[model samples]
Target: MRKNSIKNIRVNEEVHRELSNIIRGEIKDPRINPMTSVVAVEVAPDLKTAKAYISVLGDEQSQKDTLAGLRSAEGFIRVKLAKSINLRNTPEIKFILDQSIEYGVNMSKKIDDVTKDIKED
Candidate 1:
């Protein structure tokens, strides 16, 4: 199996765009934090499953709660996807907590702290 091929990249990009729009504009669950962003989408080669990486722009607890809400609403989301897209089978939707945004924020804070310390010294 070839790795990081053009087809995989295209599919992942398309999935990300569609999922983002659906979650932001279509899904009406209030528990879903409005700050939530669909960061990436990973679809299996067989297209049986899709893991959607989401970044919640808030505290840790808020992120966890939003994920729980999304998980419970998976069936509805899948049905909507089936209706919206032309596919033989709508992939099982899995919501994943993406910590990259948090990580980046933390790293920037650390760097800022170091710079401040150096300036004080």
Candidate 2:
């Protein structure tokens, strides 16, 4: 019931898969960017709450708008997830923006620049 038990891991994966599907196909908010992807999901052992990490591809404005859209549709998303999963109590959906991809890209670029400089030397 704590720290990534088998049951908790299974539940997390289920939530992640179902949420990705719902977000991709069901959400209709214009603010929600088409590039938005559910990268990860962390479901509490009690199943009362879950945090869904989303990666929004695009500029800052687009990412912000997509997050706003997701927050606005949280209730509807929760309902759909509950129905799909057949859970007695649907976990509250909390959307978190995952900026690790961007960070990684930036770091890679920096590394490339450093390597190029080294080669020139």
Q: Highest TM-score: which candidate?
A: 2
Alpha-carbon local distance difference test for all models: 0.85, 0.92
Over the full model, what C-alpha lDDT does candidate 2 score relative to the true structure? Answer: 0.92
lDDT of 2 by residue, 12-118 (tens): 89999999999899999999999889999998878899899999889999999999999999999998998899776799989999999989999999999999999
Which regions of candidate 2 fall more than 4 Å away from where they truly are?
A: none
* lDDT score of residue 74 within candidate 2: 95
Model 1 regions more than 4 Å off: 1-3
Residues 9-90 of candidate 1: C-alpha lDDT, one tens digit per residue:
7777877887888889888888889999999898887667899999999998899889998998899888877777666668
Task: Give the per-residue Cα lDDT of candidate 2 at 44.
Answer: 84
